[model samples]
Target: MTESAEVECVVVGAGAVGLAVARALARAGREVVVLERAGAIGTGISARNSEVIHGGIYYPGGSLKARLCVEGRRMLYTYLDRHGLPHRRCGKLIVANDAAQEAELTRLAERGRANGVEGLTFLTSAEARALEPALRCTSALSSPETGILDAHGFMLSLQGEIEDAGGAIALGSPLIRAEASGRGFALHVGGAAPMRLNARVLVNSAGLSAPAVAARTEGLAPEHVPQAHYAKGNYFSLTGAAPFSRLIYPIPEAAGLGVHLTLDLGGQARFGPDVEWIDPLSTDEIDYAVDARRGDGFYAAIRSYWPALPDGALQPAYAGVRPKLGGPAAASDFVISGPEAHGLAGLVNLFGIESPGLTASLAIADEVAARLSEAA
Candidate 1:
């Protein structure tokens, strides 16, 4: 058997959440090492989807998603300003195309206020059109706190912070399995070296593969690991200049927030993330190809809120898969399991982290830190 390497902390996955966890630990004066299966960081669920900083407007009241999103969005803006990251508080509008949908908009506004989101304004059709000029909504709820950020740049900043704190990130190092050791855990890493690591603190922030990774831990209770679900969302980017200045979202669908228009930091508009649930086992090998034919449905969806949408304006852009804990027809909130839930000291597991994950990364990190501290 190879000699087991020792580390103070081992963070599985190098996505936004994983990096944040490592940063928090290192800042607390703990030696940390991040292990990533991919060749680069932030390539998993973190790299996919709209890089929008969501306001805490949609989650159930008093849920972790609601609380963390609200807190994280504010902390993210401050962090971006301090780091000089590329971002903009461009804001967003949740539109109601017909009078029937108007009630939904009001409900969303109420939920936003309940979640502690400020600057939410309900606007009439004419008032909404005045802001976008091309909007065709009967009413809308404007969320001024919603915005977009350079997700890659933000991940890079977190990476820098982790490194600056004397931590290290090992690329191309996949964690094969883990087992309970004396007071810590033993992690087997699959790579050219195929080494073993005994870490005093282990964080499984593996994003999409979190459930599977947790199952591989030798001593972890099986029931504590939630069932995994994969939902593939495809995006179609606008071929020409974007029509609106801010994000335009229709009333949310049952499975997701619906096909909405979001602009990147470069001001390029894209629509999509229409949910297509896939089998959980196939998640590792799921396809991310953007079907150009899907653009047909997007045209009708976009025209509902922007009747001025021109034909053939959307082209196949990209696709990203979200890691979900619940299957279709079910809604699941973020699950951050600490030792108390699983009886695994020095370990933390994060599952069902989907939308608003980017917006809630920092707060989630804080939660992980507190959980680990409690166990300590």
Candidate 2:
């Protein structure tokens, strides 16, 4: 016989967003339990990729990404300061390689301003080069608010908040299936200690496996779950000293922010996250290995803005897959499906939470909390 338990709330996935959502729900007086498939927290999407806190520039105005990123960026800085977490407001520059691309920079600046991002400045080729002497660009859009942070540390802080508030994080516990049970959800969790849980509130913030989780939800209609797509991004670390002090980016590409340079808190610079769309596969089957041959393309992309980039400086770093809703050419907004959309009480599902997720986590938590409250 499987052991059965009960909880006031259950949050699936222990990534940054899930932890944040659990923190919000727990702090709001809800008895929350977070389920993580991995043995440790933040080992998935939250663990990989550039830890840059976006400045709400790339997303469309009024979208969840835009609003939550701007709001969460502010909230994140404050939370980091209060908790004494490690972070840096090192800023970034979105550079244009030629005059034609300069127009796109203007459009981005305008969009950034419309999204309420402060400290945006347009820079000429000379002005941009003055800031980063190694940079080569026709023009650039400077985002002083963009920065990098300790992602794992931030997630740890969120976990601390949840646990301090009397919530529990069940590591190695994956929700195998969920069904609607009297005004709540019946969750079958799998791991070393398999058990059944009856939860008054259910939040599926499962990151890459969100769609799969939703599909297992018995009461959620099929149409409510969107098809999942994966876009793998590969990063390459610089072999020698980094020439630029700040983050350097090229004009946006089809599925990613182009091969860009981002520094860790320790000042080690790495470039990458070039878009590589692979066949749709389960998260378990998706490859996270970085291909060394891909560096051939990275050299050309990097040298477009940093002409001094050496041939052998690029080394295989790591790779992360974005949980996407669309394919190579199409982009989608962060989907926070709630009771209103699917008519499921006390349940919320987050889908396609890609870039800016770490930056927008707190704000997304608040939104999720609000939706649950309204459902209640």
lDDT per residue as tens, model 2, 1-376: 7899989999999999999999999999999999999999999999997999999999999899999999999999999999999999999999997767888998899999999999999988899999999999888899999999999999999999999999999999999999985679999999998999999899999999999999999999999999999999999999988898999988998988899999999899999899888875588998899989999999999999988888799899999999989988798999999989998888899999999999999999999999888878
Q: Model 1, range 252-335, lDDT digits (tens) per residue?
A: 997789999999999999998898887744456788888888788888888999888888788899899888788897889999
Candidate 1 deviates by what RMSD?
1.1
lDDT over C-alpha atoms for residue 287 of model 2? 83
Candidate 2 TM-score, C-alpha based: 0.99
lDDT of 2: 0.93
Residue 204, model 2: lDDT of 96
Candidate 1 deviant stretches above 4 angstroms: 1-3
